[model samples]
Target chain A: MKKLIIASTSTVHNSGYLEYILPRLTSFFEGVKTILFIPYARPGGISYDAYTAIASKGFETIGIQVSGIHEYNDAQEAIANAEGIFTGGGNTFELVNQLYKNNILESLSKAVLTGTLYLGTSAGSNICGVTMMNTNDMPIVYPPSFTTLGFIPFNINAHYLDPDPTSKHMGETRETRIKEYHVFNNTPVLGLREGSWLEVMGDTITLKGNLSARLFQPGKEAKELDSESVINL
Target chain B: MKKLIIASTSTVHNSGYLEYILPRLTSFFEGVKTILFIPYARPGGISYDAYTAIASKGFETIGIQVSGIHEYNDAQEAIANAEGIFTGGGNTFELVNQLYKNNILESLSKAVLTGTLYLGTSAGSNICGVTMMNTNDMPIVYPPSFTTLGFIPFNINAHYLDPDPTSKHMGETRETRIKEYHVFNNTPVLGLREGSWLEVMGDTITLKGNLSARLFQPGKEAKELDSESVINL
Candidate 1:
């Protein structure tokens, strides 16, 4: 059975890194002793070792050791043997670029599909979708393809925010961007707000956070899915 | 001598479309009678004809005629013979995709380099840079390459916004996104805030409007370029 936790963000406001999701992660990774961290996203252009240390500190609270994929000489072997896997967030383009360059995209996808405990945050959660087209991250680097793992049937817009009613900025809002995506794509998109996550166990996927997530289907009005609701689409 | 007006946005808050910039545009296109409009970046997914009409209406105030590039049988000839060219704001990916598909990228670049008056707003202005990697638009469609006209030595981040200090959203800010770009690219980036613009005449590029634009150079702290200041980079 496939098992994964796709979160909008690792940290919420007024909290330390991964503090908000620690409890959920603990239960999700129950018997796993160590997690293989894919820190290629490199938020703020952080070094692999430094990003790994941060993930390690977060996993320590759950009594699990964390190791970065870059630390391994054989990345494919590392994913194949990982007890649990956690992909951190940063620039989605660079993350996907490195995955293709390393030629381990298939290995990682296989591990997740074969029931290995998996956790993804932000850009990490984005790849769980059919494509990286819905990502909000800047295209700092161009990937070979926009195709992602397809761990889920739909696409994810992480850290999804509603347009500020009072703001005067002329840039397109998050909702507007997603609507534009639908013009060129028919794939359904879920706007995963911060503090929200989707828990996938076997064939069932349930929203597990307090906030409601916005679901956008092609040629249809966007609707809000309440917390704990099963996401059928 | 290159002559171009790269604007941050066509419409500002609480203003009619192109209302604020009409006066400057009138003087910019002084003797030009008609402008070739590139409506590929259709805002709100509007049709090419409809978008062209809006541009036509706006240009009418300056006593200039407008014709969309799509209406022409040969886009290359239209650009080559254009007295002035205007590329409106919309999705950058789609705009660039159409540019390459129509095989007019080189022709348009050449026209601007040889002293034809040119104007660009938002996504349009983004292409005047070295690459479209710094644009804020969603990747609705994949373009062949991120490489752009390279009219200027640096990249332009159109509709550049400052980080909201009070927002609880955890997504990367505009500044953070630009910083990530510098990690993989040495190209300098100019964050053109709304209501701001760049006036390029000959080899000199000067910042216009009352607002200051943020300049991001690799391996250095981002600084603010005062209004009317010459952009040497």
Candidate 2:
């Protein structure tokens, strides 16, 4: 059986790091004393140690200790031995690049599939999808491949935002970008709004959090899925 | 001599397509007849013919004719012989993919360098830079490489926007994204805001338009380059 909590973002507006989801994390990570952290996304280009410290502090409140994967001599072994695993968010390209560089993408995917407890937020959660095509992050780095863990059937557009009706900006809105994505990609995409997450237990996945998520299918009108809805698609 | 009008966007807020910069374009493309159009970006996934039609209409306003490269017997020959070339804005990934697939990247770059007049809007202008790594586009398709024309010494963040002071959205700001890019990339980046453009004549490049553009260099503070400023870096 597989168990994971994939969140759209670690922090919401007016909240501390991971503060909004601490309670859920506490329950989800119950009985796990320490978890391995993959901090390669390096939000704002922070050092891996510094990023891990933040994740450590966040998990600390839940009475769990966090160790960065970079701190280990054998990152594959770290993922293999981790009772619980947490991947932090940042630039998806960098995260995917590091995953390839460290040659641990397979190990991480296998661990999660074999039922190691897992938590992913932002870029971390985006990897659970079919590809990183839906990410909003700038292409700061090029990964060996756009393919990801494929833990979920579809791809994720984390920090998904609705178009501002009043804005006059000409940049493609999130919705427009994803639509462009559908032009070349057949994979379904889930636009995960902030404060929203998906709780996956075995083959059943449910939208957890209070917000509704937007789902996009190629050549189909986008529809909103309410919280707690079963997201089989 | 290199002659190019690399603009941040073709349309500004509340304006007709290419209306904001028609006068500049008329003078920039002086003496040119039919300009070759690269519609590979295909905004909204519009068909190549439909997108070319839009470009034809826009160029027609300036007494110029437009023909999409797709209509040509050989795209490479079309680029090589074009009196003036215009690549319209759309998805950067798809644009680069087509450029690579058609084996015209080198020809287009060589043609532009050999003194053919050219105009690039949004994604098209972004390719004039050293790499597409700074692009704020979704990775709808993968290209052969992030390397680009290198017409300029740096990279470009087209359709660049300023951070909203009031917004509480946790998504990384445009500035932050570029900053993260600098972590792994050493190239200088110019944040070409909407309604702004760069005029390149021979070896001289000047920022044109009413607003100032932001310049980001590795390990240094970002500064604003006002209208008519020379952008040598």
Candidate 3:
């Protein structure tokens, strides 16, 4: 059975890193002593070591030691041996790029699917979907493919923001972008708002956290899913 | 001499489509009776014909007829004979995907390089840069390559927005995203805000329109370049 917590973000307003979700993580990752951290998505282009240190601090409070995959001699071995795996948020493009480059996508996916406990935030959560197409990150680097772990049947628009009616910005709204996505792709997309996450256990997927997630299916009206609802689409 | 108007967006707040810069377009596209419209970006997944109709209406005010490239049997020939070319914004990935699929990138680049009058808004303007790595649009589709026309020396972050201090959202800001891009690429990126544009006349590229554009070069501070300033870097 696959078990995962795909969060929309690692931090919320006025909170320390991973402060908002640590309580749930403690229970979700129970019995796991150490986690293999994939830090390739280095946010703002930080070094892998530095990014891993941040991840370590977040997991330290939960009594789980965090080890960056890069610290290992072989990344595939790291994933296979990790009691728990965590991919932190950063640049999805670079994360996907590095995953392809390192040839670890398969190992990482297999380990997680076989029931290795997993936690992903932002860019990390984006990869848990069918493709990385819904990522809001800039195309800082081109990955080999948009295909991802497909842990969830649908794609996830992490950190999804609703249209700000008061703003004068002319950019496409989050909904408009996802609708445009449906024109080329048939895959469903879930707009996961900040602090929201999808908890996957065995064959079931449930929306966790306080906010509602907006679900977008091809040629269908976007529906808002309240927290704790099962995401069938 | 190459002539192009690469704008951040076609429609600004409280303005009709292309109404923001029609006067300058009239001068830039002078003597052109008809313009080829590349509507592949198809904002909001609108059909090519539907998207073209929108472009036609915008260009009609300037006394120019708009013909979508899809209307022509031979897209290469259409580009070869076009008096003016306009690529409107939507989704950059799809736009580049179609351009490659149609094998029109070379022809389109050749036309623009040989002094064919050109206007690009949003997704269209994005291709005028070195790569589509800086676009804010969703990946929605996998483009053959991030490589673009390279009409200019650097990339353009169209519809660039400033950071909102009041917001609680944790998504990467436009500036942070571009900085991340710089880590992977040495190319300079101009954060072209809404209503701002870059005008290229032969070797001279000038910033046009109402506001200042932010420029991000690798390993340097982001500087604000006022409208009407020459863009040498």
Candidate 4:
């Protein structure tokens, strides 16, 4: 069984992505022979190419075009045979849709439990929650329920941050947005800021990033933690 | 019955409060009778004497020293007879908790329906959600299940914006934060930026502010609108 490495995206267009994850890739897939890429998130869009290009940086990448229960065979084969699985980010809603449409979330979960070396970033990081209800993106599209891959016990608020003073778009501040998530959820939410990554190696969840990560527990003050802290799942 | 106005706070400071609301006060209360100010939000803290100071602006402002349900008599009476109601900005979680503890959210909702001129800034603005589940600030304290005044059918994501390039805080971007909201919610959430006010008069909801307000409907593209455009909610 391989380990699961979930990450928040730093940047895909620049050297940041490689700089952030290269060391982790070396530590996790040190002796692995091959890598399989699941780029279903981009689905008929331009990001497919973008992510495929990004994933190709570390290993031999293959884009999985699977998208429904009928596509389960292909998904299973990809997960079962790949030395490591890399899931890229895009739109969480779109990712959930494709995963559900193909009935692959469950398959992927099972694979992770069996040690498939599961790797996810951004939107991919969101699906690892008990329910992917706490993502930090828009639902430009929907699949079924916002429920994600469910590899992790708590909800992940990916790409979290405080607002920029110069931004012109009007919307809820990040803090207010997460608080609202507590209304429907009893599970804690991990507000993972940009440049942060959670390394899930053999049942251990370690926080890796600068600044304090905010944790929301119902009826409690938001807890902040530095990157070196280890959060027990 | 009085008219109701809820403004999404862009920034929360002593001056920000006065600049954003002074216009609404002059325009709405123009020829009206006395204004009853509810300063129940401050609790025991007398930092700025915000209540008396706001009252000194020439309105008959009375501080509601009530904290729990036992001291909620004036809340009912004030809502019933006031020419107009203005709920100033402070901590929304505190305001919501007080309202719930006092059993006044429902009453305030009724007052709005009956046509009380209602003006809620910051924390006050947050309580207008159907469930009060919508708010953009940190959940400093937990309140009863995300329920609010319900003046607005959907949730309010106040002070929405992108991430600050210079700030050190780590969290998800505002766009991703709201996208997560869409996963569990079917109702649209209005990302009302600071300095933005949603004027609700006799069921007419208009988006007014210097910036464009973004509206997110689950499974649809986010829509942006500028000031003076009416929202049919």
Q: Write the per-residue lDDT of candidate 3 for residues B1-233, one digit (tens) a residue.
A: 89999999999999999998999999888888999999999999899999999999998998999999999999999999999999999999999999999999999989988999999999999999999999998998898899999999999999999999887889988988998888889999999999999999999999999899999999999999999999897
Where does model 2 exceed 4 Å of error?
Answer: none
User: Each candidate's interface RMSD, rounded to one decimal?
Assistant: 0.8, 0.8, 0.7, 8.9
Please write out the lDDT profile of model 4 over residues A1-233, one tens digit for every residue.
43777777635333555465666667777667656667766522435555676567544332222222222357767666666777777666677877777666666877788888867787778888877666644434535666566566788887777666764543455666666656546888888877777877666788986656888887799888789788874
Please, what are the lDDT tens digits per residue for candidate 2 over residues B95-133? Answer: 998889999999998999999998999999989999989
Residue A180 in candidate 4 has what lDDT?
60
What's the TM-score of every candidate structure? 0.99, 0.99, 0.99, 0.58
* Candidate 3 residue A81 C-alpha distance from true site, Å: 0.7
- Expressed as tens digits, the lDDT of each residue in B136-225 for candidate 1 is 888778888888999999999999999999888888899999998988999999999999999999889999998999999999999999
> Would you give me the overall lDDT of model 2?
0.93
Which lDDT tens digits does candidate 1 get at residues A55-164? 99998988999999999999999999999999999999999999999999899889988988899999999999999999998889988888999999999999999999
List candidate 1 stretches off by more than 4 Å: none
Least lDDT summed over 10 consecutive residues: which range in candidate 3 chain B? B164-173
Enumerate the candidates' DockQ scores in order. Answer: 0.82, 0.88, 0.91, 0.11
| Residue B79 error, candidate 1, Å | 0.7
Error of 4 at B130 (Å): 13
Give per-residue lDDT, candidate 2, residue A201: 96
